[model samples]
Target: MAGKRRKVPHALHSELSEYSSLLRALSTNDTLDVAKRLTESKPRKRKKRTEEESDGAAENEGTAAPSKKRRKRTEDAPVDAESTQNEAAGSSQLPEEEPNGDKPKRVRKRDGWTRWPLLVTDLRVPEFGLDEEIEALVRHCLRNNNPHPTDEDGDSDPEDDAPAWLPHLTQSSSAFLSSLFALLAHHTPARPQVMQDRLNAIDWRMVLDILATCGSVDADVINTVKTRMEAIYGPYDGPAPTRLEARAVAKSRTDAALDEADDAMFVAVRPSKRLPKRVLEDVDSDALDD
Candidate 1:
């Protein structure tokens, strides 16, 4: 009986098979679309936890575990901190050491005449016994060709004409020499060895030249004057003259000239044009009345 009833449902069976096939195609397309989306889309990534967050999470783990990890992290961190401190300290000290090693040292040369301290010391003779000797020297130099007589009663007796201190004169001469040396030394630039050799070679010719150009002397008189200067100031090697030394020399010369002028004979007149006669008379009359 069941087999005979099923023969009447053929159209219904065919229609159901066609609908099942359409549903299977739609399901296959949907699966293909999902596969394409999976291939094209970027993967979702888990973010890395910061140190603080990781430490907090670790702290939330048991107390024993967190304390051990924290101690290890602290030990590792100190090495970096110490290295940073050393770098900072080294950078700070670098500039200070650089100057000491790299900077040049400056040395000043001594003044010209000061280099002849020995000569100056020798010339600083006693003041009392040398007055006459100094006066004779001066008279000899100033008298031109005339012979300077020794006795006070001589024809040139000029009783007031007496010699002054020689040390004072020597001191002035030394100062002038020092200044001249300083001037020349300072102006000329040569190696110390060369300069010393040159100064050592200085002789009558150099002296004559100095006297001819700078000193108050004629070319013919320079030879004699050079000999006199050599007798006074000996050889020296030091720096050349400076402005200050030059000025000092000039002052010494001026002072010596003034001293000589003061020593020279000068007539003093008792004010010949005395206060007018009337003024004097009035003063005398007033005094007499009183």
Candidate 2:
């Protein structure tokens, strides 16, 4: 089943609101606003001679300390661009703003396991505990540094490296597995597979058969996942292959070994005959005490 495609959204509704507010603030800073900002600094320097010169001098550090500080702040803090001028303006008239020396509060995730850092703990399950190395693989997925389709040098570019995190905060430690292999461990054991491997693993005829009977998932979601799987890896060639099992055999393994031992040998006396002529294996005549 083919899923109806929709255009991708660059940002979410919640993010758009914040971005809109920031844009309004930025857009308002026009030629006159720039002129006012430039002219405003010099007056502040002269204002140091005022009655409150000692206190005012601190505000007159940078030619325009507030704007400079705000730009510097972007490295460590979320620029509250909506609170554009008045917040970081650093002017004495604006009530000397306190320095935000602290780093920006990171956006934590609801699942308790964060995606931003892509920790193995995010995928934690009981089959495997939190492994720190999974974070690197998650990072590799998030890296958008893949070469452009048109680039002649695309083939030459080596893999990229970078970090991004949106950590889940609500994860329980012992309750669940923190590993990707947890789900399919018994059979399919999900992990990175090249396209050809994916093709081999999947049995498309079985997919259609199961899809007809699968009632748990919405048809749309099933289509979406199926389409995504097909797009990433070519379709499977055959239906699921049969898995052969060993025939049942009695008296195997531990019980068999124990039953074979002379001291622990299993003896069966028939009810009809009561006891056989030789009730058990004949004892070694020479070894037995006379």
Candidate 3:
């Protein structure tokens, strides 16, 4: 019965206003509708006759005139004109409504630099196809070389009159070189002791050639590539050979290939006609040709 019945109080609206403030402070936006319903359902107060007015009515008992009684009542309960005006103004103003449905926005931290995300289920190969020439270059570099006490590779060979035949560098070549260097530096998979020897065997000039060929690469990237190359090959004042030397070396290699009959895979075809020349004539002709 107590739950079914509701009672209205004089200060119900003021109490609801206080409750709303408390709800807002606690960040409870969901319960605002219930508060609104409670405010609307509160019972209205009924006008009552005062004890003073009833007693006065009995005392007068129609003896005194109605005008005299009215004057006496007005004198006893004096009203402030300003207070009445303020109350009227306050009553005319509507209560502000709360946005009960909206949820509070959350603050997020600043996003910084992030690495390229890799998942275990991702494709093992690169998304884009890599160049075959680049792969060949990487394989060539990765192949272990026998250790030598002296710096006698193609780069350091001074006595050879022929120029070295260096491979033409391309975009693919540079990319491959950079990636290989990264792999070696990072010691990918697992760090192996053989890496140091393989790195040492790598000719620094080859790395520079790759750098020089990369026309569109960033300067910072080039510098990093150079730094990594140096770390692998070690710092040196000697520079890579010029174009002329490389050409000469290429010529020598061609000559070497031609000199080898077995590796050349060409059958020797003897001349059908024999020259009827003296032994002295043959020597003189061969010397002249040379």
TM-score of each: 0.21, 0.17, 0.16
RMSD to the hidden true structure, all candidates = 47.7, 27.0, 33.9
Q: Is candidate 2 or candidate 3 better by TM-score?
A: 2
For model 3, what is the error of residue 119's alpha carbon versus the real structure, in angstroms, after optimal superposition?
4.0
How many steric overlaps are in each model, in order? 5, 19, 7
List model 2 lDDT by residue over 149-182, tens digit each: 4455455443332222323321332123432123
Candidate 3 residue 238 Cα shift, in angstroms, is: 28
Q: lDDT tens digits, residues 156-239, model 1?
A: 554355446555786666666567766544433244763443323234444444444454433345445545655655543322
Instruction: Report how far off residue 184 is in candidate 2 (Å).
Output: 2.9
lDDT comparing candidate 1 with the true structure: 0.52
lDDT of each: 0.52, 0.42, 0.49
> Could you tell me how far off, in angstroms, the CA of residue 127 lies in candidate 1 after the best superposition?
3.8
Could you tell me how far off, in angstroms, the CA of residue 128 lies in candidate 2 after the best superposition? 12
Which segments of model 1 are wrong by more than 4 Å?
Answer: 1-133, 138-201, 223-290
lDDT of 3 at 89: 91
State the local distance difference test value for candidate 2.
0.42
